[model samples]
Target: LRIIKTVPCLSRADLADSFVLQASKEKKCPDTDYLSENGICCDQCPKGYKLIEQCHAPGQRSNCTPCPTDQYMENRNFYPNCRSCKRCKRNEIPVTPCQPTQNTICQCVKDYYKFDIDGDTYECRKCKQCGVDEKEKQSCTPESNTVCECKEKYYRFKNKCEPCERQGSSFFKSTMGNSLPVCLTLFLWESKVSIFYTVIRRHATGQWSKQTVNYCTHFYLSLSAPHSHLSIPPAALSDLLYTVLDLVPIQKVKQLVRSLGVTDTEIAQAEMDNRYCREAHYQMLRVWAERKSLAGVGGQGELFDCSLMQELLDKLRKMDLGLAVQELETKYGTL
Candidate 1:
């Protein structure tokens, strides 16, 4: 508690030297040596060097050597040998390579994979694709590979699970309208150059009986040449008529003339097809008809009218095929 001469600011180097001298006087290990695990002062090996020999006495230095080019010792230790450097696997890639004082770290290659949720990792498995009748459910990750599942239309076909074709041969539509291929032809139709209705061996790609012709509602003009298929392209009507009619939309239709631009040969061919379709539809209705009439069964009557004449010239004076088809089909029912 008595006030005496005090020195407050001491240089760092002199302060450290005084502290080391006092610590040594107290029997601590000197700067040249460190306390080993066995409680003896020994010369320690530096990182990247391993001890080749140990000292039995406190003042003797341990024999040390640098780790070999292909080996390492990452920390100071009394061990007598360096560890062998890690080698990359065939499917593994080095992230950080081995150095004098560092260990090599590696990971699975891009095309390699493993599914370890938690625990030690095993060898990488190669990436695989979903096979036939299967679809990818989950994409691959660095840790986990892809997952697959059977497709919605998977069915046993020709001894293997295969994708079902849309309403083709062997496929049938269920009551709920789910179509599956059955590998058998349920129905078919054959025509000339233009294929009519063909449910071939694969998918359900075919034609229908009545070829739809969309007449413009405003200009009262034919939008496109009539043909039979499932999808009707609606924009062609809007695009074509808008160019001519002051951009006004199409209106109600006129009583039919020959479809615009359809050739005479096509018209004759169309007449034959229509005659066949009318009779086919008529026979179906006759089954439930209280007053059945097989009037136009064999193309014997007029095509343009109900006149009983094989001479087609009478209707040539004024023929409207679309109106005539409507009148013929409604002879029995309203459809």
Candidate 2:
């Protein structure tokens, strides 16, 4: 009988060590070269060129061609084709033009910033402009938007800046107890109405002083002079009508105008007179307002009144258009 030799089986640890040794012993291509399909180390194509054919022998250069226009090859590589260059989108300006060896770099134009990303590119949006009573705290940049703050003597209200109102010296004395009476006059114009407040206060020492306080137009009308007839000017009335139109859909606006006594022919004529839908809607509302004024107690030339606004509000409520009604109430305050 022939004698048989037994071989030892490798443990898990021994197999792992064997794999590590094998990996360490394997040859790796240098940074300037890449391993070919034939297991040969071939020289790489330089930047701006793409590989057309592999090297025939080790240490030999590969066949390469320059990248076509609007294409790029950014690094020494073994790729068969060059990459396509990037293009700038709307509201964007090219920072660095695309070249054979590099991709295009883009940035937002002046008064715009990067708002979002679209795949591998950026989408730009217009910057915000501060209101008249506000000042810019930070200027807008390509990467960031504008920052605004209320100016001196103004306070922020509902995202807008409004001038601060002055109270009489007596009112301040009641609150602060050590103030002297001062005279001032404040005039404000709103809806073609010029309003000014004059207050006279008698001091404890028998001195007479006059004081004036400027209050917000809407606030004063709503609270202090509730019974006063504050007629809405024609321009202000037009703005409110447009606001109503904007709160509802176009179909709803047509329904509203019709309900307010605008004829189909009138709507068609308004459409012909205006190029835009919003302008046409405004025209229809204007006609409705004119008709209502003509039928009111005040004569044909009377353009605006509190009754007209209340009537419009009543019609909107009857239509169950709560959003439009709410917007008008919020803007005009109990009109």
Candidate 3:
């Protein structure tokens, strides 16, 4: 027979080795509360607020206060204070006006550029000078990128300007005459123009050439492939030569659209959908307003007066439109 005896705790030392050890389990804070280091469960402060007082014990609330202007709390926090808001430099402008949830986005002011494309880099870089083969397609502004396109007769060769040479002919031998089919030259022009900003060579030529071509001549160019050129209808030719230029600063473009009856301005409407381009449009608008000494209370609608918007609309419209078929045929040639 075996006799088993159980011992009872009578002193502090005995309690340490007691058969039935008891400990209060740690409590988990609910989603609405923060589990503090002191083991107190304190309710979370709302957004834009910071906790100033902690709960005395579990199942209690904390004291919070609204963050002051130029300061913000993005999330519910037990922090003693809100974070300081971001500010734009004197030379920089706010592209996105600051909000409680997001910081003010700064863009370099007019005639300036941000050298880096990296989003995290905050400094606006100096606007670079135009390349040798490049012309100012659009001037640099604080918010708009400097756009450059090759000058006439110069072609973009690996982004550098190289003189265009007519095929099967020398510089002197090559004439915009009958030797190079005017239609063929036009085909090359339409085929090589890239995304409204011309910078490509004929897929067939394998070399870059920039010479004035009869882009409107009643000729068709097959665009089904990257470099295939075939005779196309006059309408197709016009469509091929014209594109909704993506490089243009959109805000000034928008001014024209508003004056032209918004829907008739198809190109402008399409551009508004692009986030980067759309913001650039607004940025340029502010610069324009300042230049013209225009009064603007707030919002995009007040950017410019309706009566003064016609001239800009006409200029932008011409860039988006190519020569009509009848005009090309009457003056130029037919395929």
| Top lDDT model | 2
Q: lDDT of model 2 at residue 322?
A: 43
Off by over 4 Å in 2: 1-25, 117-121, 166-335
> What are the TM-scores, per candidate, against the unseen true structure?
0.32, 0.44, 0.39
Candidate 1 minimal-lDDT segment of 10 residues: 187-196
lDDT for predicted candidate 2 compared with the true structure: 0.68
Question: Which pairs clash in the backbone of model 2?
Answer: none
Alpha-carbon RMSD of each model = 30.1, 19.8, 18.9
- What TM-score number comes out for model 3? 0.39
lDDT of 1 by residue, 21-135 (tens): 6655565565656665434578778889988777766677888999989899888876778998888766888889998788898777886665332224356667657678767
For model 3, the local distance difference test gives 0.48
Q: Write the per-residue lDDT of candidate 3 for residues 1-335, one digit (tens) a residue.
A: 99999876488766653432332135666788877655667898988888888887766689888887888877777889778878886568888876655567778887776443222444565665787766886776654445565676665433455554533221212234444422233224432321112223355858656444312211223443442423234454233223222323333366444443444344454555546765444434434433332332223221223222223334443433212221232222222
Query: How would you encode candidate 2's per-residue C-alpha lDDT over 1-335 as one tens digit per residue?
Result: 99999989999999887775665457588899887765667999999999999987767789999999999999999999999998998998899999999999999999997753322435787887887887897788887666566676554444455554632222212122555443333332233322334456788999988754443332222112343434445666667778888776676788888888899999999999999999999999999887776566355343454466667877875554544654665566432
